[model samples]
Target: MTCLTDGEPSATADTDTDTDTEGELLLRVLTAFLREDVSGWRTRSTPVRRGDGLWLRLPVATRERSRGAALLMPVLDDGYQSTYAARLPLLRREPGGAEFVDTAGVLAALRDLADPVDRGGFEAFAVECQQELDALRLHAGTRREVESLLSERYGVDPGSWTGLAGGLGYDTLAARADHPVYPTSRGRSGLGIAQLRSYAPEFHPTFALRQLALPREAVTVGGGTESWLSPRAAGAPALEGSHLVLPVHPLTADGPLRDALRTAGLEGRAYLVDCPGPDVVPTLSMRTVALASDPTRHLKLPLATATLGLRNRRTIKPGTLTDGAAGQRLVEAVVDREPRFRGVILHADETRFAHAGHELIAVLLRRYPAGLEDAVVVPMAALMCPAPGGDRLLIDHLADRFHDGDTLALLDATLALLFDWQTTLFAHGIALESHQQNISLVLDHPAGGGGSGGGAGRTRLRLLFKDNDGPRVNLARLRDVMGQQAPARTEFDDRRIFVDGDRPVLDVFTTITLHLCAGSYAFGLARHGHAPLERLLRLVRERLAEAVERLGTAPGEPGALLRAHVLDAPELPVKAMVTAGTLLSKERSGAADINKHYTTGPNYLRHDHPRQNYPRRNYTRPTGTS
Candidate 1:
């Protein structure tokens, strides 16, 4: 096994193969359909008797359509047939009933669906989806290999290593990056398999960053204090003169940016000077790389990869860089002022820069919290990831702390922290897109011991948020809270800080945090038989209600509006990626408005029964042989 440390580069080896096979393409489409909820399919189960043993048979279904083309007609009606047609075999019709289908019968049915005449204009989308799916599967295989290799190299059982190794963070992050719960784009990365292995965090790939030293006047720097950049300059002596050193991703050095660097009057033939410090590895967010020497400082470099259903170029919009800086300052101020919010830390983007007309070179700098070294920070998405060498979920590792492996206890601790964070942000009129990737849980084990022992006492779980660019602030609330402390620029045009309407601003936070973050986790846990979906939803409602009651104390408090919206509103705004993709397909000009696409759906919190009706149950061990 290859042993690579942070700030050290591994020799590149070619492992490329043709990934665009028919079976692989079909799997990708099936995964995406299951993940994005494109046709509103739900997993339903029926009891079946087989030879004297009774079994619960679960099948995927949609309203009015259960099997055959009928089951997929709704998706086709939505103009996604081209994207889904290749994967139809995966949903084979049952012998007698049209409802239950054979999900495992995909390979045999691959050739059954030839180029159908009905798929007229969507042929291109279908092709792209298939290609992307194939690429995704290839990456998934690489991820599995990386995990297995890391487990073996460390001489620890897969998924059981609890030490705070620098490599462990990237290993777990890479494992979580697979986003196993959602089938869509499973393991599908924007970079190819070989590039993924070389540069992606999952593969534990590390390489020295190529540096570009440009005259200070050639680039525009914004949003950072002079002290922040001073430390960064110490590592690069090439920038000794008044030049600023910018780190470039290794892949970017070999790609389109090469020409741009040459034009900018760089020395080397490759147009990038090799920086001498430690190599950095990419995180779950492909663009953000953490230093091997110092885990606290993370450098966000520009990599044009189409992952998570969006193509990110790492470039900040015209004035948004300054806006991000101001937002960070405001959040810091709020955190300092509010005691309840002090637990949550927003990893602000301290600095942002772009070379003149070279937005591709833009980078954002962020620092992890100081004095929290022992804490194990895991992305929320990784909690449900399958543990290596065991059927249990990765989150199950924390179960030793709870009574009788009661996962609900863990859920409660996480929710309590999330409530404090969310409520504080809401009260301040700031909405964060706290999805699984953007949010991390800092699990502070008890002081005296480690792992299970750490859980014996109260385990403190706090929320740490990154990517400060997306938070939407309400100008009205800012003025009320900050008073004279508000930035002077806010007086001229509130548009810089505040979004247009109150509801939209609130929607950005609620939809992503509540629906995408909590909702997705509930479904994932239920899928793995760890906990019932309703149980988790009920817990969420209870926590929200408690928060509402506590915040409702002061008259004119924003909590009242939030309370009503969460409890009484019939539907909650959901960012529907498939619906958004369809809308983007219709546009003939300019870049797609990927962020604006939203669809309202039934709120899970609103229930007909009184809150007390669903009494909390004791932490009984899950059913099966003890």
Candidate 2:
């Protein structure tokens, strides 16, 4: 059923003796078998041999222009013989063994490398055209039609308060005319409300939410645009939401997060916010709806993990795409492109809070349920997934987030943790793309743990990673619809409607990663680049003897440490945003007092780019879905 390999399979010459980084060797090996250019390509190898000398194989979807990429899955022993007899190949082999194509063919052979030795004491060896029953039975339903049915089954107005339009079955990422964010009785339409404060500077966000602030005026910015923000938990002094823009360096004692919280008077009561509106009054504080719960709250992402096979890459609509492949590109920026990076952790059910105004900072997660520090990872589920579009970062190292081990230290100390993080991530074979916007750095009193006392009340890093919404499950999956093994299937490949290039990886990352990582890297270059980048470069230095230092220290799972930095948010202009902003300001001040405006600290930039026309669709054949 695959659209690849017409008629009899084509042949290729044997060319395997190449000396290079495992990355290169793997690519050549993968290429020989895959037999076509791959997109969202990823490579992983053991830092050193372990256990029965086995290497874990992982992959995401295949977004390439040719062939269908599927996570060539792993199967052991004679089990695959039957699958292959039915034409399923596990493409695998020994460390110094032969290779071939077809998922089953490749993986089955690779697993055999770990097989037990013969009675003579040498590794068992032999290749057999083992065949099994010609009938394994095909499923009754066509996989592609499932999404169509799910969308129809749900129907609009299935109406749970939690339900909202996120393009699940709409066939487009950004809304279209019939789609309902805005009703046009007009020519050009805007998706979000323009900031009312831009015009009505005196307006304040409001709603009865206790411990919150609201714009005073009833004016709505940009048509019906509404934004929400939460003040820091440590407390603020101001008691009014006076259209104020506090300086990051602060010209006064009270800081923004604290000031915003105080002005909103949220220190006292709890308020519920489940309103209806194009502009329901703003709720500038945590809601009684509950913040972090005793039970971990979770938010599933719109992104799917790395999948294989060429997804329907024909640009079908006008908004940024939000499938697993797009997410994989984001992840690659974080895991493969140098410095290590991990993604954000959503509150048990806090996917909504992660992206709402003021709720985006990692500092907010500092309010985790009391005893959950040691329980670093939490899975919170919700109706909507909120991973910012693209890999671009908009960091908010809130001024209130400046204590000892707080956000500040997490930034500086990011270097010391990359070793375990990068290796763990490559193992997953897909990056988590845990950029700052998606994650939080919580600071609390140390009931116990190392440097517990010193970082107490400041910040003791417990790096968190989540968001299955946008995963590049594994490299193999990117080549084809990785069957049913993907970590999570997407609600829809709605984001593809917006991707513009022949390959989704380049376009998505160019926009998202450039935006996010540019800022982070700039922060580092401005702050401490040598350390973070070197963390990886050093691990991968001259002879890699560096890994020898800690023979047994790799984290159990890839992305285990999930440190979100340049490697984690590479598409970002990690070094550029900081650079551009600096360039702009220098010109503004004529370079007279440049140092006054610039700093090693990452300045938060959170501008929400609205959705536009669905780029023209560029269709290839209907290969298969990832």
Which candidate tops lDDT? 1
Worst 10 residues of 2 by lDDT: 131-140
Error of 2 at 127 (Å): 67
| TM-score per model over all chains | 0.73, 0.27
Cα TM-score of candidate 2: 0.27
> Tens digits of per-residue lDDT for model 1 on 162-266?
322432443444443334322233333344556666776666667777766566666667654333333255465545556666677776767757666565554
| Per-residue lDDT over 1-626 for candidate 2, one digit per residue giving the tens place of the 0 to 100 score | 11111342221212331111112222222322221111111233212233433232433223431232233322211110010001122233343334454323443433333223211111110111110000000000122233244335433221111111111211111111110000110111111112211111012222111222233231112112122332222133242353211111110111233543344343232121222111112111111111112223221111110111112111111112233323433443444433424332222222122211222111111122334533222111110111122211112211122233233334333323432443333333443344333333333334544443333343444443333234323444222322333334343353322222222222222223222322323223222222333332232221112222332325532222222222232222211121122113344323232111211111122222111211111111011211
Cand. 1 Cα-lDDT? 0.53
- Show where candidate 2 strays beyond 4 Å: 1-204, 208-409, 415-423, 450-459, 465-468, 473-485, 488-492, 495-626
Which ranges of candidate 1 are over 4 A from the true structure? 1-124, 139-144, 152-183, 186-190, 223-239, 259-271, 274-277, 310-320, 343-357, 401-404, 446-454, 488-497, 553-557, 581-593, 609-626
